[model samples]
Target: MSDPLDKATSKAPATLGEGCLSRYDPDDLSSEDGTEFPGAAELWEQLQDTSDSPEEQASAAAQGRH
Candidate 1:
């Protein structure tokens, strides 16, 4: 290709639904697409243990402590 932009161009995987409900089609995704996150569950649990619930955060923010 003659244009440098051609090398930078990338396309998203196929999607499903429409509007706010739209999302990537899982069946079309692969590891090459960076879809794998092996530590996500562990990280989620760690975050859950360290962070307060939404209601608690809102209360802290309203009290000007957040």
Candidate 2:
């Protein structure tokens, strides 16, 4: 068995936020390059499949009665 203090020290240190890995001083940074991805929201909405066809939905309803 390990001591409580030893077990605590064996684990890694925690950061401030869930998604953040390291601290950032935004004032020290500058941006470069000009690559762009446009219409991302429109493309995502178009790609989603919300409903099935009328025939498929009707067939599914019929099968579920069993």
Candidate 3:
């Protein structure tokens, strides 16, 4: 069997700023252009389903943060 450390080191390094391997600095999410990504509507729909009304859902979601 191969040594585990040797196996890990032998693999190719990931391409920078590519795919999920890209490192995210907090500043990268500050601008609309930098932070624009898919799934806002779908996430909102999920939150809506968890509460009886839009107002209730928003309140519950706010509470969930803390």
Candidate 4:
């Protein structure tokens, strides 16, 4: 893996008191404790995107999409 701290890396370290949404709960993305993001069904529904056709799914998978 590439070193994120290497000088070549363009990534900048977060300033003090920085809080990343993705790091709200590293162990559980759902944030079941409710301290961070609430476990909202609407969010999950939006992520599924059932409107996409089967061909689109195959194309996305072939392109290495999550």
The candidate maximizing TM-score is 1
lDDT of 2 at 23: 44
Error of 3 at 32 (Å): 7.2
* RMSD score of candidate 4 (Å): 14.1
Better of 1 and 3 by TM-score: 1
Model 4, 1-60: lDDT tens digits are 886668573433333434563333334333344446456777886777676689988988
* Predicted candidate 3 versus true structure: per-residue lDDT over 10-43, tens digit per residue: 4333334767867655553454434665788898
- Evaluate all candidate structures by whole-model CA lDDT and list the values in order: 0.88, 0.52, 0.61, 0.58
Summarize candidate 2's per-residue lDDT along 1-66 as a digit string, tens digits: 776787563433333444555744444433432223478777775654235567776777798921
- lDDT at position 58, candidate 3: 72
Which segments of model 1 are wrong by more than 4 Å? 1-8, 53-66
Residue pair clashes in candidate 4: none
TM-score of each: 0.63, 0.23, 0.27, 0.28
- Alpha carbon deviation, residue 28, candidate 4 (Å): 38
Q: Please report the candidate that would top lDDT against the real structure.
A: 1
For 1-66, candidate 1 gives per-residue lDDT tens digits of 498776776778999999999999999999889999999999997886569888988887899977
Q: Cα deviation in Å at residue 12, candidate 3? A: 37
Lowest lDDT block of 10, candidate 2: 27-36
